[model samples]
Target chain A: MTRIRIPPTLREEVGGAREVPAEGETVRELLDDLMAQFPSLRRQLVEDDEIAPFVNVYVEGEDVRTREGLDTEVRPGSTVILLPAMAGG
Target chain B: MVSYRDLLAQAKAEIDEVDAVRAKDLIESGDPVIVDVREQDEWDEGHIGGAVHVPRGHLESRIEAAAPDRTRPVLIYCAVGNRSAFAAKTLLELGYVEPVSLAGGFTDWKRNGFPVELSAGLDARKRARYSRHLLIPEVGEQGQLKLLDSKILLIGAGGLGSPASLYLAAAGVGRLGIVDADVVDESNLQRQIVHSTERLGEPKVDSARRTIEALNPDVEVVAYKERLTSENVDRILADGWDVIVDGADNFPTRYLVNDASVWHDIPVVHGSIYRFEGQVTVFKPGEGPCYRCLFPSPPPPELAPSCAEGGVLGVLPGIIGSLQASEALKLALGIGEPLIGRLMLFDALNAEFSDVSIRRDPECPVCGEHPTITEYIDYVEFCAGTREPA
Candidate 1:
C-alpha cells in the first residue's frame, strides 16, 4: 500500500484525511484504487484518462511526469504527493 | 636587558627582508599573501594593491585567518618596515615557512610609485548598524556593501510583502520599490505587520514605506500607488532592479511578474500561502526553470482559490515571506546556493519542509528556445481561463 498525501485544498474530497493508503504497483493502479474508494477524486485528479494538466503527482519525492507518468512504478510504503499550482500570496 | 635598537636589529637579522622593487616584482609574479600590519586609520588612508589589513595588535590572533596556508610566502609591511620586521619574526615563530618583511614598508613602496588601494570602508554608524553581518565570513564587509547597493522591487505590500519588505529594509537594501493599490484595513492587521492600525485608510505602499524607513533609514522606498497590470509593468520595470520579490495576491499579477521577470532577465523570489501551506522558490531566468515551466497553466478557478476566499494562517505568510527575503539576499550577494531550480513547500500544520526539483521545460513558451508568446498579453483574461495562453 502506498500512502498518498493530500494537499490542503483537496482535503474536502478525501473526507479531510491528510494521507490515505491505497494498493497498487504503478501510479495508474494506485490512483485507480484511490478513485474507486473516494469517487470524487477521479474528476479532481484525472481528466480524459490522464493526470490533469494542472495537477502534478510525485512518487517518492520524484515527479511522476518526469519519470513514466501514470506508468511509473510505486514501491510498497512509498509516499506519493499530489501538488497543484497555488497562486495565493 | 638589550636596548630597543639591539632588539630591532636582532629581529631584522632573524627574518628575510625584501626591498620595495623586489616586493613589487614578487607581487607581480607570484601569489604572495601581503599583510599590511598598520593601524586602521593608516591602512584606510592607503596600502598595497592586494594587501589584507591586520593591525599590529591583532597580528597574533588574526594572522591565521588572513593567511591560512603557512607554506605560502607572506609579505609583511608597516609604515617604515620597523613594525613589519617584528611581525615577520612573529610569523616565523608561528611556524610560517617563508615570511618576508618589506625592507622599507609602505612608505618606501609609495616612494617607488607602487600602486596603492584606498579603502572605501563603511562609516562608524554603518559599521555599528551592520556589525552582525560584518562578523559573518560569508556576509562580511563586502557582502554588506553589496546589500546596500542592491535594489529590489516588491510586487505587493500586504501579507507576504510585509515580512519581506521589513527584513530587506532592516538588512540595508539600498532601494525598495513597492507596488500596491489597496489601502490598509483593520482585517489586514492580523498578518500585514508593515501596516499599522493608525494607517488603516492609508495606501499600502505609503504605509509600508513609512514603516520600512522608520525601521532602517539606510533604505530608500519608492512607493507606487497603483496595481501591476500589463500596461504599466514595462514602465515600472524600466527603472532597473537587481532582484524582484513577488508577493502578489492573485494569479494574474503572478503570471505578469513571471513573464516580465523573464523578459527583463531578473531573478524573482516567489512566495505564496494558502491556509496552512506555503510555497517558496527562486525563479532565476536563463539559469533555471521559470514559473511557466512549473505550472504551464493556472488551475481552474474552482481549484485555485485566493487567500482571501480560502483564508491563510496568520504566521504562514511571515514564514514564507522571510524565506523570500533570505533568497533575495542570497541572490543579491551571489553567495551560497539560491533556490533556482527547487520548489520548497512548507506545511505549517505538520511543521514540515520539503523540496522538489523543478526542471526547465524545453516546451515552455516564455523561456524555451523557440518562444511563441513574445509580448505581454491580457494576464487577467488568461488566468481566468477565458483566453488560451500561447
Candidate 2:
C-alpha cells in the first residue's frame, strides 16, 4: 500500500482526505487504483493517458518525470506527492 | 606607588617590542591577529590593514572575541607605542602566549609607507539603528553596509509583496522598485499589511512606498503604477537591479517575470501561495533551474486557481514572503547557501515544511543549451490555454 498525499486543490475531489491508501507496483497502477475510487481525478491528473504537463508526481521526494514517466516503481509504504503549479501570490 | 612614567616603563620592559619594519615583516609572513588599541576617532581615521579595533578601555573585556586563540601571536598597536605597550602587558596577564607591541604604532607604520586602511564608517545615527546587526559575525558591519547598497525590484505589491517589501525595507535594502497596476482594495487588508484602511483607493505602488518609507527612512522606493509586460519590461529593467522578488498573482505575470529575469541575468526570489500551502525558491539564471525547468507550462484554469478564486490563509503569504526576503538578503550580502535548485513547500495546516530538488532542463525554451524562444511572446495568450505549450 502506498500513501498518496493530496494537494489542497485536489482535496475536494478526494473527499477532503489529506492522504489515501492505494495498492500498486508502479505509478500507473497506483493512479489506476486511486482514480478507480475517485473518477474525477483522471481529468485533473491525466491528459491522453499521460501525466498532465502541469502536474508533477513525486515518489519519495523525487519527481517521476525526471525518473521514468509512469513506469517508475513504487515500493510499499512509499509516500507519493501530487503537486500542481499554483499561481497565487 | 609608582608614577605614570614609571608604570609605562615597567610595562614596556615586560612586553616584546617590534619596530615598524619588523612588524610589517611579521604581518606579511604570518597570520598574526592584529589589534589597534586606539580611540574610535583615531582608529577610524587610519589603522593597519586587517587590524581589529579594540579600544584600550575595553581591551580586557573584548580581546577574547577579537582573538579567541590565545596561543596565536598577537600584534598590538595604537596612535603611538605607549598605549599598545600597556595593552600588550594586559594581554600577557590574560594568558596570551606571545604579545608583541609595535615600537612606534600607526605613526611609524605610516611613516614607513606601509598600507593603512581608512574606514568610511557609518554615522552615529546609523550605528545605533543597526547595532544588533553589527553584533552578528556573519552580518556584521560589512554585511549591513552591503544591504544598504543593494537594489531589489518587486513584481507586485499585493499579498506576498506586502510582507516581503516591509521586511526588505526594514533590513535597509538601499533601493526598492515596485511594479503594480492595481490599487489598494478593501479586501486586501486581510493580508496586505503594507496598506492601511485609510489608503484603500490609492495605487498599490504608492501605498507601499509610503509605508516602506515610514518604516525605514534609509530606503528609497521607486514606484511604477503599471503592470509588468513585455512592452515595458525592458524599460523597467533598464533602471538596474541586483535582485528581483516575484510575487505576482497570475501565471502570465509570473512567466513574463521569469523570462525577463533570465534575459537580464538577475536572480529572482519567487513566492506563491494557495489557501493553506506556499512555495518559495530562488531562480538564479546560471546557477540553478528556472521556472520553465520546474513547470514547462501553466495548468489550465480548471486545475490551477489564483488566490482570488481560491481564498488563501491570511498569514500564509506572510510566512512565504518573509522567506523570500531572507533569501534576497543572503544573495545581496553574498553569504549563506541560498535555495538555488531547491523548492521549499510550506503546509500551514500540517505545520510541515518539505524541500524538493529541481534541475535545469536541456530542452528548456528560454535557458537551454540552444535556445529557441529568444524573444518574449504573448504571455497572456500562452497562459490562457488558447494554444498548447510546446
Candidate 3:
C-alpha cells in the first residue's frame, strides 16, 4: 500500500495517525484516497479544487511539483510527505 | 510506546542521568564534573554548588577550561535538557565519551526537589535589563543561549552602539568587542544605552564595558578604545567573530566595518538608524552578497544623517539594537534559518517589521567573481574620495 504521512497540524483530523496507507496508481489518486479518509485535509491541500501553491507534496524527498504538479505517479510501498513552506526567524 | 517527539526526547533523556540528587552524590564523591551549560545570566542566578559555567554553544571551544582533565567524567545541564543535549553531543563529538546529560535539565532538577539558585537575569534592578526580550516568543531560552554563545563586534559605542552593546551584553553574548575612540559625551547619553548620564567624561569603551560587566558578568567585554580606520580594521577584527554590528554614527566607519567584515568572511549585521526609521541587513560574503553589492560606493556624506545632525529618539536605538542582537544570535546558533539573504526593516512610528528580499548580485564588487576590490579599503581615503583611506 502507498503510505501518506500527515504533518502535525493535520494529524488531529486523521485520528492522530502519523502515517496512513492508501490505494492508488498515481499521486493524485493517493491524495484523493487520503482526502476521502480525512475530508478536512483535502480542502487545505486542494483549493478551488486545485492544490495550494505553497503546500508542497514530496515523494522520496523530491518535490512532486517539479514533476507532475500533483498527478505524478505513485508506486506501492512509496512514501508521500506534505509540508508547508518553512519560514521562521 | 513513545511517539517520535517523545522518542527523540527519550533518546536524549536516556543518555542523561537527570537526578540532581545523584549529581549531588556524584559531586560529593568526586565522581564527575557538573558543568552548567546555560548562559552567564542563568549561571549567575544559581547552579549546582560545584558547577562550572561553560555555555553550551562554546562547549567545544572552552571545554578545557571548564573540565581540565580529558578523562574526568562530566555531567552537563541547561535550564532544561535541550541545550544540554546539544552540549553533551558536542562533548561526545570532541571525544568526551564519559560525559552524560543531567536529564530534564535544571528545570526538572528543581521540580525533583533539588534546590535552585536564582539569578536576576531579565529581572534587572533598574527597569530590568531586557524585560521586553523575555516577552518575545522567539527570544526565549533557545534564543537567549544563541545570544550568549554569539561573538559580535560593535564598531562604535556611540548612539547606535549604545543600545546594541547593552542589549547584546544583557542577552549574554559570550564575547563582545567594542571599538570606539571617543569618550562619552553628555549628548551621547540621550541615545547610547551603554553610557549612563553619570559616565559623562569617561572613555566610551570604559562606560560601555562597565555597563555590560555589571549587567551580566558572564560576558567577556573587550574594549578597543580607538577609532576604526584602515590601519586597524583588519587587525582588530581578528577574533573570528560570527557577526559584526556596525552601529557607527558615520558613513566612513560604516563602510569600513562592512568591508572588513566581508574580507574576514563574517556576516556584517548592519544597522543604520535615521530619525524615525532604521534599516538592517545581514551581508554575508559569497553567500548572498556583501554591502558593496547594494551600495558600491559610500553615499556622498551630507546626504546621510548623522545621529547628531538628524536627532534620534532616545528609545529608537533600543529597538534597532535589540534586533541586531537577535540577528547575531541566530547567525551563531545555526538553529532557525538566518536572515543572510533578507533585509529586516523597522519603522518605529508605524511599528512595522517588513522583510525585504535580497538576492546575490553577480556584479557585487567584494564577493563577485573577478572581484575588483581585493582588500579592505582605507575608510578615510574612501570617504574623502581623495585616496581610499590608505
TM-scores, one per candidate? 0.89, 0.87, 0.52
Per-residue lDDT over B253-357 for candidate 1, one digit per residue giving the tens place of the 0 to 100 score: 888898999999999999988899989999999999988888766666666666665688888999999999999999999989999888899999889999988
Question: Residue B246 in candidate 1 has what lDDT?
Answer: 94
Candidate 2 - chain A - TM: 0.97
The most accurate candidate by lDDT is 2
Clashing pairs in 3: B18-B103, B45-B118, B45-B119, B148-B172, B162-B193, B378-B389, B381-B388, B381-B389, B382-B388, B382-B389
- lDDT per residue for candidate 3 within A9-65, as digits (tens), equals 345678877688888887788888888988877656765555564355767655565
What residue runs in model 1 are displaced by over 4 Å at the alpha carbon?
B1-17, B26-35, B49-52, B56-76, B82-102, B381-390
Question: Deviation in angstroms for A34 in model 2?
Answer: 2.5
Which tens-of-lDDT digit does each residue in B113-183 have in candidate 3? 76665543333442244446444445544355556667889877765677777777776788999888777
Worst 10 residues of 1 chain B by lDDT: B381-390
- State the TM-score for model 2: 0.87
The per-candidate TM-score of the B chain, in the order shown, comes to 0.88, 0.84, 0.62
Residue B158 deviation, candidate 3, in Å? 2.1
Per-residue error (Å), model 2, residue B341: 2.0
**After superposing candidate 3, which stretches have Cα over 4 Å from the reference?**
A1-89, B1-149, B380-390
